[model samples]
Target chain A: MEALFAIAIGTLTSCAVYLLLRARTYPVLLGLTLLSYAVNLFLFASGRLVMASAPLTDQGLERFPDPIPQALVLTAIVIGFGMTALMVVLALRAIHATGGDHVDGGER
Target chain B: MNHLPIVPILLPLIAGSVLLLSTKWSPNARHAFSLAAVVGQLAAASMLFVTVREGPVLVYALGGWAPPFGIVLVVDRLAAALLVLAGIVACASLLYAVARDTETSAQRFLALFQFQLLGIQGAFLTGDLFNLFVFFEVLLIASYALLLHGLTADRVKAALHVVVLNLIGSALFLLGVALIYGVAGTLNFADLARAIPALTSADAPLARTGALLLLVVFALKSALLPLGFWLPRAYGAAAAAVAALFAVLTKVGVYAVLRVYPLAFGPQAGELANVAEAWLLPLALATLAFGALGVLAARSLRIAAGWVVVYSVGSLLVAVALFTEGGYAAAIYYLVHSTLASAALFLVVDLVAGDRTSAGDRLDTADAMPHGALLGSFFFITAAAVAGLPPLSGFVGKVLILDASSGHPAAALIWSSLLGAALVVIVALSRAGSAVFWRTLSPSGGARAPRPSLAALAAPAAILGCIAALVAWGGSATAFAQAVGRDLAKPAVYVDAVLGGGHAQPDDRRRLR
Candidate 1:
């Protein structure tokens, strides 16, 4: 399970980095979204993986997953969503204004 | 629990919500309301500053939950001083926007402005790492909209860079936070401070990596070299008032560095002591040199001002890199001085550019602008201050920084780089000044530009007056900065106040939940 999680994060981050280095706004936006996903997953796993042990369980439960990282991941997800929406709109506007999708607003 | 610590954050949050809902109101009414809110913030910040001075650190826990578990807001002398600085800049910039009639041109300008304040002040006051990330996003989102407030081709392009870069920065911020939380088992700053020093040797490397990653995020925000290439264009493309307010934005990153590294990884931290010290000074000096070259290479006054902002950050951080009380004190004094100086420069650029028909702030000889003498005087004084000329606050700031670095091993390199940057800046600024004010071509655009209203002049003039006051009251300001430095140098008081000395009932948190 740990290996799978680490591999998933690594793949997402590598892909994100590649896309981020592209010379266009849309790709960069996608890259940012992917990076956020990787980050969110990373934050979620920071508290050590646990199964059948959710927070807010019955009072007599002997063990539970650390709840703080769950809360943090949730917050990260919300903020990431908002940021992605904002970037989508901003990229569209940039493309419209410059009549090109190049990040620098000029032909390469 | 004096509620004043939260006022700076809450006042702006309330004001922004109110302004957001008042879209149907007249511009005058919105402006008046926003101005009142900013004035209230200034008052609260001043009171908070006074209360924290020579007093215990003020801690406010949210929902009565104790630290190492719940979120906390801690205000020491450093945070209080930054709060006041943020307030002063916000007030002046808002006043400038109101007087210049720029606020009415955009939808929800007043609302966004107030939200930006909330983010800045909240970042300053929050004692939780996660909370700081949230506030950073708040400010960045608001700034994104504000940057594109008066939509232009240049602005859109600049916004794309600024937004994308910051988005990447946010991702890194999360990664760093997660790493730190995993290794340290805590997110609250004070708690983390206590948890870090006892890390096992196996965990030390991971925690150090996380700390350094966090530093990278901050450096990116602060516009340290190689990461700051986007700053000039983005800042130049922003509206005058927005740019003025942003003068302190980079300082937020510097504040985080000063707050986090010194406290968590200070002299006492085993293996990670002075984690950032080795890299900070050299990078800072490089950034200063790069900013100087940028200033000389910029094609316009606004872009030059942006580079000056970058230059000031580098200079301020050089002092901070020393990690001594004297170093922190110098950095604090210079931080206040440079924030105001750059802000005043931006406002003055707007005025000068407005007074011309076609010149439009480009650093070129053009038709003589109206009130050239008056605007020229403002530009000259501000330029002198930015270039660290004598008789202004910038000179004093540089001297203090130099004096603080006198005992460092790299004192020679620091002195040469700083002094060289100042000399280059002086030349670049003088050239810009002469191009705009001194070497004027014949009037080209037909109608003469009108003189700016006294109200418009008042804002920038008032900011300049603040700088002059820094000079006038140099003694007291230095003393205050030293006090802040002392407080920062010893984080025990700040830690205790937040984690142990607070009124929160941690045992009841579970039941409440």
Candidate 2:
């Protein structure tokens, strides 16, 4: 489970980095969304991973599975949703306003 | 009142909501309300400052809940002092807009400006790392809207980059927060401080990763060295008043970096102590050099103002890099001075270019300035203040920073680079001053530039006047800054106020659950 989670995060992060490094706006946005996903997963996995058990500790566990990371990831998701929406509008606005999608608004 | 710590954040939030809801309010009416709200905030911040200066840290847990469970707002000398500064700059920013912009412009500005203020003050006071991230978003989202206000292609382009970059910053911030919480089992600073020392060996690596991630995020936010490419491009394209207000934005990054470095990883950080000291020092010095050279190479005053902000951030990182009492104190003083001076310079840059019909702020010798003498003096005073001229707060602030760096091995490098930055700024400003004002003097012909109304000039003039007063009272302010430094050096005061003994139960996870 840990290896799978690690591989997923690494793959997401690398893809995001590649997309982010692109010269165009949409790719960068896509890259960022992936990056946020990577970060979100990484944050979620920080609670040390739990199986079908509730986020809370069950009948025999010493402590609750740590609801904090769950709460943290939930907040990040909401914020990321707003952030992605804003970026989409901004990229569209940029494209409309500048006639180019290159990150620097295209010197042309 | 007694809820002093939350007022700075709450007032702005309430005022901003009111502004957002009252779509029917006249632009003039909205402007009046916004200005009134900023003044009220100034009053609240001043009250907080006085209370903090005379007493201990003021901790206000939301909903009467306590730290670690309920989010707490911690107002120490550092936060209060920053609040006071933010209040003043905010006032100047709003006033600058109200004075110069039309009613329509004012209508569009109020809610966003207030929201931005809410975020800034929130960042200053928030004791929870997650809360800090939320406030950063609040302020940043407002800044994004404000940045795109005039909607010029250049600004929109710049805003796109800023939004994307900051969005990434947000991701990293969350990433860091999560790792910290996972390792320490809490998101509160006070709790983190306590828990970090006892972290199991296995958690250490994750904690370190979290710390380094946070450092990178802050460095990106503050526009430190290599990560600073987007600043000049974005800030240079922002409106004058917006740019001026943004002087606080970079400082937020500085404040966070300074806070986290010491509290999370400083001496009490136990095994984590001095984890970042190795890289921050050299990077900061290089940032200073980079910013100084950028200032020298800048083509326009507006762009130069952006570089100056970057330069100021560099110097601030120097203070953090020092990681000593004197260093923190010096950073505090420099922080205040740089915010004021940088904001004032950005404003003055606009004023100098306000009346020029062609070559707006290009520092050219072509067109004559409309109010050359008055604007010229504002420019000179602001330039000198920024470059560390005598009898100005910059001079005193730089001396404090240098004094703080006295014993460090990098002292000489910091000094030379600082002095070098100063010299470069002087050259840039002088070249800009002479070309933009002097060379187009009466020797050629009388000035033909249109004069800006007194209203437009008031805010920058008032800001510069404040700098002058600080310069005159330099000694006392320096002393106060030193006191703030000593207070921050001991995080116990902050922790005790927020999560110390009796409040511990209130913050326990069981109660929270």
Candidate 3:
């Protein structure tokens, strides 16, 4: 299951990178969002990919997933949301001002 | 007083919140509040510096949580010194802003500026990798807002490039952290120090790949060579104060590279350590050559600021390449000097621009020496300092770096480049000065004398004073560099502080899980 999740994230990251390399603004923004999601998941999985339960305390349980990475991912998720919002606003403003959404505005 | 370590970050954080809440207030009130906040931050930073200098490395665990689990703020001598510099620059720029009436949307700008300082301070002080990323994002976001404050077409365009490039860097950084955490199972610097040695001995490839990923992220952030193309464009297009503020941004990247690369990978006590330096040295030399050439090729004052970015990359690379205590000291010393000189130069450029009638014609008019003796002298001094002439802070820092790198072949190349670049910079800046401030205009030698306002004069004076102080205290400054170099060389101080001292056995590692 952990391997599957890692593969899935790796695929999404590649897709995001390709889209981000495009010349259009909207697709680049989408790419960033997708890339951010992949990053968040990847960070989460770094704690060794627990499937049965969270890292919360339980009676007689010797081992559990690390909680630090989870906490870090939570923060990243919040910050990532902020970043995406800022990018969207910036993109919309650029589109409104330039009347186009291309990265270099066809300047070649 | 024990809690003072976090105050450098908290003061600005709280002030920004207050500024946001007081959005409907008069701009005067906002500017005053911003000034007060910066002054307070400066005070807090100074106090923290004193504390760190006098005591053991100050560590303030966030929310009272210890390290390796909860977040921690670590204020060693080096971090404290940087905090002090950031506070000073932010305050000086704020003063200039107040005088120029450039404090548009004063509350928002001040809030973001404070947040930017917070982010810088956080990055310097934090002991956790994830926290570093958080601070990087915070600083970058604040920078994006600050860069677009006036929303000129050039600024917007430049800011778009900066944001896109930086976002890619940040993504790479996050991926590096993820990979490192996957293998090491801890994000704290101290824990990583303990965990990495064993991991490298067992699986060198994972460690090497993670280290390389981090290096790329930092190189991009520091504007090294090819990855640095976006910096001059973005930074050169912003307002003077904004550009001056950004002078510290790339240094943060250099600081991270210095801190992480040496501590984590450079001293791994195995074959891994040998391979790490081999990769780092060439990259450093390339950065140095690229930066020197870039500065020579740049045509405008703004473009020159871009060159300074390159110069910093080169200087830092010299230290990393040499990988000696003296080399690291030289790097830290040069870091301090470069930040001050660059900020001073940018402020001077802004002063010149302020007296012009239009942005395009600003450089043209400034060349006419409209500001008279006072402003001209100020400009000459700053330009000289930035160009690294004798007896200035820049010269002192460069000499220390060269001295530190002496006797090594890499040092020889770096020193020659340093001297050659200095000569070229002096020539370029002198020509620029003559063209912009001393040359008589063609057709009619009678151009209107630029009557710069008192505020314009004060701004550069403030920055120059800071530079002068650094130069005058060159002895202590070198001593400080040596101290920081000692600390950096002995990563044990950091590891001990972060991991509560002692090695983590394999059983203990399992217990941590």
For TM-score, the strongest prediction is 1
Report the C-alpha lDDT of model 2 over B357-463, residue by residue, as the tens digit.
66688866666766778888888989998888998888888888889898999788889988888888788778888888877633335455657778778898888
Positional deviation of residue B486's Cα in model 2 after best superposition, in angstroms: 0.9
Docking category for candidate 2? Answer: medium
> Quick one: best DockQ, which candidate?
1
Question: What shift in Å separates residue B395 of candidate 1 from its native position after superposition?
Answer: 1.3
Error of 2 at B147 (Å): 0.9
True contacts kept of 3: 0.52
Most lDDT-accurate candidate: 1
TM-score of chain B of each: 0.97, 0.96, 0.94
Which ten contiguous residues of candidate 1 chain B have the minimum total lDDT? B504-513
TM-score each candidate. 0.97, 0.95, 0.94
**Residue by residue across A2-77, what tens digits does model 2's lDDT show?**
9999999999999999999986988998999999999989888877776776567666665446677788888888
Q: Write the per-residue lDDT of candidate 1 for residues B250-365, one digit (tens) a residue.
A: 99999999999888989878988899998899999999999998999999999999999999999999999999999999999999999999999999999988887887999877
Off by over 4 Å in 3: A54-57, A106-108, B103-105, B268-271, B274-276, B358-367, B442-450, B501-506, B511-513
- Model 3, B1-513: lDDT tens digits are 278888877888999999989968888888888999899988989988887775378878788766666778888888898898888888877787777745443668878888999899899998888889999999999999999888766777777777878887887888889888877777787777776776745566766677788888888888876688788878888877888889989889888877786677656535457434666667666776666666667777777766766776676677756777888888888887788788878777766655443332233433344453565677689878877787788888788778887877766676777788677777767766666666644324444645666765676687788788888888887888888888877888877766674435445665756
Q: After superposition, how far is residue B390 of candidate 2 from its true place, in Å?
A: 0.5
Give all candidate RMSDs, comma-separated: 2.4, 2.4, 2.5
All models: lDDT? 0.89, 0.84, 0.77
| Superior by DockQ: candidate 1 or candidate 2 | 1
TM-score of chain B of 1: 0.97
User: Clashing residue pairs in candidate 3, if any?
Assistant: B367-B436, B370-B450
